[model samples]
Target: MVHIVVLGAGIGGIPMAYEMKDLLGPDDRITVVSNTDHFHFVPSNPWVAVGWRTRDDIMVPLAEPFARKGIAFKSVGCRRVLPQENALDLNDGSRLTYDYLVVATGPELAFDEIEGFAPQSNTISICHVDHAVEAAKRWEEFCRNPGPLIVGAVQGASCFGPAYEFAMIADADLRRRKIRHKVPITFVTSEPYIGHLGLGGVGDTKGLLESAMRERHIKWITNARTDRFEPNAVHATEIGDDGQEKAHHVVESRLTMMLPAFRGIRALQGVEGLVNPRGFVLADKHQRNPTHRNVFGIGVCIAIPPVEKTPVPVGVPKTGYMIETMVTATAHNIRALLDGKEPAEEPTWNALCLADFGDTGVAFVAMPQIPPRNVNWSSHGRWVHLAKVGFERYFLRKVRKGISEPVYERYALKLLGVKRVQEQTRETTNV
Candidate 1:
């Protein structure tokens, strides 16, 4: 019987384990390894930071769900991935072997890249539930004594949606508390423009976001490379088209929340032919590692190039729907290997995103997240915000019940009239 190991329990990993279980034989075992015992909805983190959602509201304990699914679950975590041996070194001095391994550990927040840029340092973070819980406490204190606020993604950051979401959400929350005028909000980003969002401004996101910011009286700094976060001031370098520092500015703020660059987890770093220079897993069109045939990668830990060149580095985002496609493709490809057939399935890599402000939001669809796509659409309204809330509730229910269905394909994409996977041969797609 084949023993498949899935590393992580987040959005991609949890669904991956459930989907693999459905496809594999009764004797084929699946084990899920995660450092945390619970799964937290990442998209709701912005709301959590501002006291709308609590930790318990978004978190799902994986032990019960996995047990109900007849799957082995380990929360000890992984210390290192030994791809050559087809094994893993667990955190508690134990070794686990597997016939095939799916690496979906997600990205390690690189807050240390900038001096005093971590949640423990001068800034607050909403990347994790724990971070958001602490950020909520800070938010309450900041609201009571309102001052200037800074919010945006730092250099080399990929997930730009959360940064934009938090900025608008914070604005909305402050207005409700009647402290928005007291807090002068400044949006500091590494993108070349206001809504570049690391995908080259999806479907006039530039126009929509810039207009929204103007309406809310939010100031912005684009092509900004944050150097350091002082106690009450942020030192940044604004870059020009010539790739040189155009000017240096010190913006003072009492509160700050900046998204940091992401790198692969420490466990997968420095593995030859397995990871890129930044430690992202190198996967082919089929989601299989070029060097390690038995290994597959999905989600934020996998490498995807930037959409275009800008003065400051901006990595492409791996959105929820895009990552879902990766999980589906990996599951089918692995199943093909077990059946003694060549892997033919390929993920469409489509991006369907909902960036919610507390009351209103923007939604976009990129047929293939890399751009130069077939369907490039974006819209903004209160309905998008409602859709985002419904998504959180729907996703949590599925995880709690151990449901393996692809929610995006069945609901989100069907509503949008989009496809999930290509389902064609590698030769047909010229892969």
Candidate 2:
């Protein structure tokens, strides 16, 4: 009997397990390993930080759900990976051997890279649900003493959407609290432009996001290199298109929230040829590591290069839809492998997102996420906000039942005309 192990029970792993179970033979076994027992909805983290959501709202216990689905769960976490031995050393000094492995462990927040950059420092974070809860507490205090605000992704940060969402959401929340005039907000980012989002600006994201910030009276500093943070100020340098420093600014604030750079978790670090310098798993189009064919990678743990070089580093975001596409392709490839066939599947890596503000939002679709794509579109509306809320509940239901690609997901995608995987490879052969 085949024993497949999935690492990390976040957005990617739980769904991956369900799809794997449905695709694999009945005799095969599936076990999920995570450091925590509850699965947190990462996308709603910005909302949680602003006091719109709580820890209970986004968390679902994993053990009970896995038991109901005939899957196994372990929360001891990983000490290190022994790829050659096909085994993992757990933090509790136990070991798990697997016939095949999927590395879906998400990125580690690099808070120490910059001095005074994390929650314990001069800033608050919303990257994780716990951090968001802390941010909410600090937010209440910040509201009482409203002042200038700085929000953005620091240099080497890939996930810029949440930074934008949090900034706008915080602005809206402040306005609702009748403290907008008292707090001056500044948007600073490593991306060369407002909506580059590490993919060279998806559709009209550049125009729409910049417009939204302007409308909110939020000033910005693009191509920014955040030097460090002080008690009440953020010091950074803005770079020009020619790769030179354009200006320097020292923005003062009562509260600051800046996204941190992402690196690989300690478990997968130092595995030669298996991961990049940043510790992201290296995989082929089929999501299988070239050095270790039995291993697969998905989500933020996978290595993706920058779309283009900028004055400061900016990595591409592995958004929800894109990660789902990766999960689908990995499932198909693993199933094919079990059938003694070569892997031939490749994910579309499409970028679909809803950047929610307090009461309005921006939605975008970039098919085949890289540049020169087939379909590219973006729009803004209050309906996007409602849709985002509905998505949270629908996704929670999926986790509770361990139902991947549920009927509603399929029918909804069909109704909206969204393709999940690459139907045709770039290769052309003459018949």
Candidate 3:
């Protein structure tokens, strides 16, 4: 009987376990090793930071669900991944061997990359549920005595959506409390523009997002490289297109939240031919590592290069849609290997995201998540906010029920329909 061990229990790991379980034989086993005992919906973290969502609202206990599905669960975490020996050194001082391994251990937050850039320091983060919980506490404190606010992503950060979402959501929250006028918001981002989003401005996102920020009176500094954060201030330099520092500014703020850069977890760092210098797993298109065929990667821990060069470093985002595709491809490919056949399935790698603004939201889809794609679309409306809320509930239910059915394909198909109909109408009218 084959044993498959999946490391991590976040958005990627939990789904990977369920999908693989469906494809494996009855005797074959699946065990999930996680650092945490519960699964939290990560995309809803911005709301958590703003106190719109609590810890219980988005979190699900994993033990019962996994047990019901006959999948072993462990929360002791991993100290190291012994790839050469096909084993893992558990934090509990035990060793677990596997016939196959899936490395879905989402990235470790690289807050130390910047001085005073973590929750314990000058800035707050919503990257983790725990951080979000703390940010919520700080949010209440900030509101009682609000001042200027700062929110954005630091340099080398790949996930830009949540930064934008949190900034807008905070704005919405302040306005509802009638304290928006007392606070000035500055969006500090490494992106070249408000909508660059590390994918080079998907379908007028630049215009749409800039307009949204203008409506909310949220000032932005693009191509900004933060140097340090002191109490009530952030030091940053604005970079020019010529790659020179155009200006240095010390922005005042009573509250700050910035999305930190991500890297592979410590356990996988510096493994020859397995990880890059930044500790991200190196995997082929089929999600299998070439150096270790039995190992696969399926989430933020995998290395994806920048979509394009910018004045400041900005990495491509692996949205939930993209990660789901990776999980599906990896699951099918592993099943193929178990059947004594070469793996053939490859992920589509498309991306779909709804960046809720607390009131209204922006939604976008990139057909391949890289440039030069077939479908690149973005839209903004209150409906996008409603859709995001619906999706959070739908996804949480999927996880709690141990449902392995793929969901993003339906969203992709719907977007495709809208895209084609719009194209045909434009052609018919010669507009």
Candidate 4:
């Protein structure tokens, strides 16, 4: 029997385990290890921070679901990965060996990178349930005393969607409280343009996002580098084409929410040849580590080279659909390797993002997940909000039931019209 060990139980890891169980026979062994037993619905974190949702509404335990699928689940944190020996060192001093290993621990927020910005400093984050809860408390306090608001992503940050969502939601919350005018909101980002989004502006993203910000009266500072954060202000710098720079206005923010840059988890850090300089595991097109065939990585834990350069640095964005595609491909390849059959390489992921903008939401699909795409579309309406709510309920149910449905692939191909586009592209190229 082939023994497989998966690290982390986040969105990427849970789906990978279910898919693996479905593909492999009952005789095969699968183990999932993580520090926490509950899996948090990260996309709803913005709503949680705004007090629209609670922790219980967004978290589900992993033990019951894994047990139902016949997979061994451990709540021990990973201390280190000895890939050379095909073993994992746990926090409890026990080493688990495996025929194959999957790393999906996700990204760590580097809050310490900026001055006066630690976990519980002048700023707040909605990256996790605990953080979101704390942020909600701070937000309530801010509501009582409405003032300037600073919300956005910093340099080298890939997850821009949440920043946009949080800003919009905050605006809506203030309006509901009849304090919208009292609170001056500023959308500050490191992107060269308003809608760069770390993908160099998906089709019409620049126009659409800019219009949304304008309509909301949300001021913006583009190509901005946040130097640090004081107690009630954010210090930044903006550069121009002439190689000249100007000191950015110190926006007095009573409440600030900034998404920090991401790095790989500590367990896989410093593993020679296995991870890149940023500590993210480096995998081939098949999601298998180039140096160790038995090792695989998916989702934010994996290293992806930047698609292009911007005035300020940018990293690849890992959307939910993109992560699911990588998980599916990794499971299939791992199964083939265990069976001693040649593995089929998986194609690059296309991104599909549905960002909720309070009263309504915007949906976008980008082929190849970067600029210069073949198909891209965006729309905003109340139905988009309804669709988002339905997705949340359905996803939670699926996770709780341990259902290994191929909902991701079908959703991707259907929504993006990839199959038809690929067929046309092929025919055109051949002619």
TM-score winner between 3 and 4, please give it.
Answer: 3
Enumerate clash totals for all models, in the order shown.
Answer: 0, 0, 0, 0
lDDT of 4 by residue, 222-336 (tens): 7777889988999878755443575566888988998888998888778998998789999999999989889999889899877776667768888887888888889989878
Tens digits of per-residue lDDT, candidate 2, 10-111, equal: 888988999898897778899999999999999999999989999999999999889988889999999998899999999999999999999999999999
Question: What ranges in model 3 sit over 4 Å off?
Answer: 411-431
lDDT of 1 by residue, 1-431 (tens): 99999999999999999999999998899999999899999999999999999999999998998999989999999999999999999999999999999999999999989999999989999999999999999999999999999999999999999998999999999999988999999999999999899999888899999999999999999999999999798999999988999999899999999999999999999988899989999999999999999999999999999989999999999999899999999999999999998788899998988899999999888878887876677889998898889889989998999999998767776654444323332345676
Candidate 2 RMSD to the correct structure:
3.2
Assess the local accuracy of residue 256 in candidate 1 as a C-alpha lDDT between 0 and 100.
95
Pull out the clashing pairs in model 2: none
lDDT of 4 at 146: 82
User: Better model by TM-score, 1 or 2?
Assistant: 1
214-282: candidate 3 lDDT, tens digit per residue: 999999999999999887999999999999999999999999998988999999998888899999999
Instruction: Give Cα distance to truth, residue 265, candidate 3, Å.
Output: 0.7
Model 4 stretches astray by more than 4 angstroms: 241-244, 411-431
- All candidates' lDDT scores? 0.92, 0.89, 0.91, 0.84
How much is the lDDT of residue 180 in candidate 1? 90
Q: Determine the backbone clash count of candidate 2.
A: 0
Query: Rank by lDDT, descending?
Result: 1, 3, 2, 4
Tell me which of candidates 2 and 4 scores higher on lDDT.
2
